[model samples]
Target: MAELQFREAIKQAIDEEMESDENVFIMGEEVAEYNGAYKVTEGLLDKYGFRRVIDTPISELGFAGIGVGAAMNGLRPIVEFMTFNFAVLAADQIINHASKARYMLGGQVSTPIVFRGANASAGQLGATHSVAYDSMYAMFPGLKVIYTSEPEDAKGLLKSAIRDDDPVLFMESEQMYGLKGEVTEEEDFTIPIGKGKIKREGDDVTVVATGKMYHIAQNAAKELAKDGVECEIIDPRTIKPLDIEMIIESIKKTNRCVVVDESHPFGGLASEVGFLIQREAFDYLDAPVQRVTLPDVNAPFSKPLFDLWLPDAKNVVEAVNTVTYRK
Candidate 1:
């Protein structure tokens, strides 16, 4: 095991996969010469040379289309969008083309590609750049979506995503790139998609979170524990093929739940997870499910406003207290 930064772990996964597979290559804006906008692809260009570590112009749609075409022709391409906010410009390629190509071609082609970058709020980036699109992209049938919090999950899940036959949307938090955690150094370390892990166990309530929100949930859980409120933390690492079963089981054990998410309150992971819990474990629930999410509005640029807009430990603690009837 090795303690690695979140960005370093991601780079390790991509680096290892590319070294092992001749068909794997990386291409995106500033990826080669600039070492990636967030430096996640640092040193990759030197390691793999210009042929494998290619850079592109600031054209999300064009590069995305090229990645899709590469994938269809039996190449694995990792497409970094700098931030998912820019991915909106390439939604036609991501949602329509890359997502549906395999099915549209009757399984004749496999889009073994990964579209990844920072997601959600990254400290007052403003409305245009802080939108969370996990739920929106997860709605697609053929695309697999993953939002990892810890370095271990980041490394393992990314490896699996690169090798999977389906296209993957790997979301990271720009705020969490510096987070350090123990990650497996094994060559073939891989975590399966659609499997949720219980970060902490408790009997009072289940707090579900993903990406950076997981850390918020954990901090809230610690405070809750101090108050005799044991809260279980579950990280739904993969959002698209949601580990509904894991969350449901936790709810059945705890009989209460509080979902924490960075997305807006409506039609996001919180809404979907709350719905699934009710549907699958309604009889077991002792109280209504609560959610801690951003208000139904765009992210603000002001520092104070942005701080209030993003969900944090306080919001999660309040939601947990609500569901557990502690307040």
Candidate 2:
């Protein structure tokens, strides 16, 4: 019943998890005395001390490797990147190593590691630093991905990810960090990894969204309501091991679906949802599944261009119309 900004809720999640589990520690760029690049780690160094809240050099691979190795050795490590764009430098460690090590070793080892921080276009951050890549991370089977679109869900999801027995990728949006929402006062609150929650119930169409796009879909549903179009907004919450059953159930009821995601249409969340829908619920669809996604090009630097590239209310409305057989 407490109101907290996205960043505050995240900070509380990390602080609480670390205090309760001595094996859990944070290692990231500027996480120590500097209090993290986004200040998500603010005041943590003083409370937990430097050893537990380490500020690493600008070496994503080095720190990521250390975190994975530590997790294998029985410590829970939260490794943060300044932004996920910079995580490319650590891909070898994340994709080939951290993501596959457990399976490669025949399940003899468990990596309780959480690689987190901002993902997606943040203002004028440009092509090099912008773009949502949680969908990209889903290619690795051993990695569990958790992305939340709100402050409260972010806290609940991140806490769940950190406490899990496997490697987790907690994708967040830098733009949503300052946003505020009422977070629960309960410490035992933890969201499951492969569940979907319908934020709105409607009959005309189902809009499946994740991360920051969930809020955009909510707004789009509101706008569509004005035009006498009903939209059901569902958040997959966790991309991998996706709640395909829940989505199928929704589509079976609505007979139409529109997927809204910030990632590109090709080989992204949109495509995955579309694939699942056709495979499991094609007979139930009244119209084709329409996906509103970013253009399959690098994220642009210009503000207007950036706006055009990301999923928005206009795109959602258009997709809703498309799937509902409207112009």
lDDT for each of the candidates? Answer: 0.92, 0.89
Tens-digit lDDT track of model 1 for 1-327:
899999999999999999999999999999999999999999999999999998999999999999999999999999999999999999999899999998998989889999999998888677999988999999998999999999999999999999999899999999999999999778789999889899998999988999899999998888888899998899999998999999988887999988888899889999999888888899999999998889998888999888888888998888887887778
Model 1 scores worst on lDDT over the 10 consecutive residues at 318-327
TM per model? 0.99, 0.98
Candidate 2 stretches greater than 4 Å from native: none
Give the lowest summed-lDDT range of ten residues in model 2: 187-196
lDDT of 2: 0.89
Model 2, 159: alpha-carbon shift in Å? 1.1
Alpha-carbon deviation at 190 in model 2, angstroms: 1.0
Best by TM-score: 1
Clash pairs for candidate 2: none
Residue pairs in candidate 1 whose N, alpha carbon or C atoms collide under 3 angstroms = none
State how far residue 49 of model 1 sits from its true place (Å): 0.8
